[model samples]
Target: MAVSARRGAPLTLEEISSVALRLIDEGGMEGLSMRKLAAELNVNPMSLYHHVASKEALIGLICATAAHHVQLPPDDGSPWQEQLRELALAYYRHVRAHQSLWTYLQNHPEAVADRQMSIWQALYRILRLAGVPESELRRTSDVLHAFVTGFVVAETRGHLPDDPDEISRDFDTAIRLIIHGLAGFSS
Candidate 1:
C-alpha cells in the first residue's frame, strides 16, 4: 500500500488547509501534531510537507483564514463611528470563535504563523475607514485590539456576572466610550 495508490493525486493546498483546520478545531493548536493530522487525513506526513512545510506555516494559514473572516465590508454610507464599532465587534466574534487558537496566537503568534501582516492590513482598513491617521492609527489600533482580546478572554471566563447580555452591552458601551474620547482628535 503505497501513497500513490490512495488518491493518485496530490492534496491541494485548500484541502490541506481544511483538514488542518479541522484538526485544530478538534484539538487546540498544541494538539495538532503532524503525525496526527496526517493520520486524520489518511495521508502520509511527507505529503503534508509538500503542502504546508511545517506546523508554523499551517498555523499562519489558519490565522489568515480567521483574519479574512473579519475583513470590513465596503464603506457604503455607514458612519465612521459605526464602522469602527462593527469592526471591533467582528474581530471580537472571530476571537470568540477561535478562542483556544486566539490564546495561542497571543502568546506565540510568531511560532504559529506569519499572520501579523494580514492582521495589521485588516486593522488598517478599519482605521482608514474611521479617518484615523497612520501615525495615530497604530496606537489606536493596538488599544482597540487589546480591548477586544481582553474582552473575549474575560467573557469566556465569566468575568462579568450580571445579565448574560451584559457582555454585549458592556462591549457596546466600551466602543462608545472610546469614540467619545477620540472625538477631540478632529479626524
Candidate 2:
C-alpha cells in the first residue's frame, strides 16, 4: 500500500490536479470527486479545499493542465496545409485520449473559450496562412474546430468504422476536403 502524506507535509495544487486528472482519465468526469481525490492522495477531503475551491474549480484546473499537454505544431514556416493537418491530428489525439473531458468541454464552451489557448492560437495562425481575413478568422477557426472535434467525437463514439487504417484514411480525406474548401478564401 502507498503511504499517505505526512501530517506536516502540505498538499500542493499540482499534486491535487495530478491525482484528479488520473481519476478523470480512469473513470471519466463522473468518477472524480473531492472525496475520491483525497482518498487517492491519502489526505483529508478538506485538504483538497485548500488547493481548489470546489469540484468545478478543480475540473477547470485539470482542463487547463490537459490543454497544456496538447502538442501544437510549431510555426516552422511549413506549408499551411501541412501545419493544419498536423494541428488537427494532434488535437484529435489529445481529445480522444481524454474523451470524457472532451465531452464535458463540448457541453461547456466557456471551458475552452480562452482565445489565448495554444490550440486556438495554432488554428488562427493556420487560418491566416490559408488566407482567412482577420475579420473571418474567428468564424473560420470555429468551423474548423467544430469539424475536427465532431469527427473525432464520432470516431470515438463508435459511429465510424472500427478499422484504424480506415479511420485514418477517412480523416485524411476529411482534411483534404477542408483544405480544398479553404482554398477559396481570400484576404
Candidate 3:
C-alpha cells in the first residue's frame, strides 16, 4: 500500500512492525529510522511514537515478531536428543530466513530476551530431560544457543556452501555431536 492510502487510517502495531521490518530488510538497521518509517507509513514521525515508544522499542517489537515464527519442538515422548535437534533446526531455519533480524538480534542481544525466553525454555527443558544438572542448565543452554546461532550466521553468510543438502547434513552432524556431548552431562 502506498503511503497516501494509509494517510488517515489509524496505524496498528502490526503495520508499524511490518513496515519497520521491511525497512530493515531493504536497508539494514541503519535504514530504519522514525522519519523513514513515518514516511513509509504516510504518517508524521511523531505518529510512530504513538505506536512504538522509541527506535529501540521498535527493534524489540520487530525481534519479537520475528521470534514468533521460530517454533519450538513438541513436548511429546520424543527422545531428548531428537527434540534438541528439531528445536535447533527450527531455530536455524528461522534465523536463516530472516538474516537481517538475526543480525539485529546479534548486535543487540539485550533486545531479544523477552522473545528468546520461550526458545531458551524449550532448550533448557530438553537439556533437563537429558539429565543435565541444575548447576549446568544455563551453561548448557548458552552453549547450544551459541552453536546454532554461530553456525546459522556462518551458513547464511556463505562461509558455508550454498547447497542446502550439504548444509542440512552438516547441521545434523553438528547437532548430533552437541547432543552427544550433552548426554555426557546426564546423571
Candidate 4:
C-alpha cells in the first residue's frame, strides 16, 4: 500500500524509515535525499524534518531500525562458540541482504558507531563468554569485527570467488579461526 501524508494524517517514523530503506535498497545512499523520500511518501520535503532532523539522522534512524531486524543467536545452553558463529552468520546474511546500506555504513563510520547497536552488543556478550578480559573487550571486539567485516568487504567488492558454496566455506574457515583464536583467552 502506498503511504501518504496527504490526507491530514501524520507520517510515522516507521513509515519514513521503511520507505527510505526501500529507496536505499533500490539506489543506495546517493539516491536517498529528503526530496526523494518526501516524493516517495507523498509528503512535503520539509515535513520529514518533523520525524528526522536531517538526512544523517534519517540514515541513523534507518540503521537502528535495520539493526533490530538482525537475529541474534539464542542464549539457550549452546556453547558460546556456536552462538558466536550463528551471530556472525546472521550478520553476514544481513549485510549481504542490504549491500548498498552496508556499503554506505562502511563509508560512514559514525553511522554504525553507536555502542548500543545490537550487533556490537551481541559480539561483546559472546566475547565475554569466550573469556576475554573486561579491559580487552573493546579492543578484542574491534579486532574480531574488523576481521569479519573485512572479509565481507572483500567478498562484496569482488575480491573473493562469486560461488556461494565457496564463499560459505571461506566464511566458515574465517569463523573457525576466530573461535580458535579466542580459545587462548580461556582461563
Report every candidate's CA lDDT.
Answer: 0.70, 0.83, 0.82, 0.89
Q: TM-score of model 4 relative to the true fold? A: 0.93
Clash-forming residue pairs, model 3: none
Residue 151 of model 2, lDDT score: 88
* Tens digit per residue, CA lDDT, model 3, 1-187: 2233458678888888888888988888889899999989888798777777889999988877766667889999899988988898888888766678778788778988762467777887898999998898888777777888788878878898889899998898889889888889774
lDDT tens digits, residue span 38-140, model 4: 9888888888888898999999999999899899997787899999999999999988988899988878989879988888888888888999999999999
Clashes of each: 0, 0, 0, 0
Residue pairs in collision within model 4 = none
Of the candidates numbered 2 and 4, which has the greater TM-score value?
4
Cα lDDT tens digits for candidate 2, 106-181: 9998766778877788889889999999999998888988888788878878999969899989899989999999
**Total residue pair clashes for candidate 1:** 0
Using TM-score as the yardstick, the better of models 1 and 2 is 2
Q: What's the lDDT for candidate 1?
A: 0.70
Order by TM-score, highest first:
4, 2, 3, 1
Off by over 4 Å in 1: 1-4, 111-119, 162-164
lDDT for 41 (candidate 3)? 85
User: Rank by lDDT, descending?
Assistant: 4, 2, 3, 1
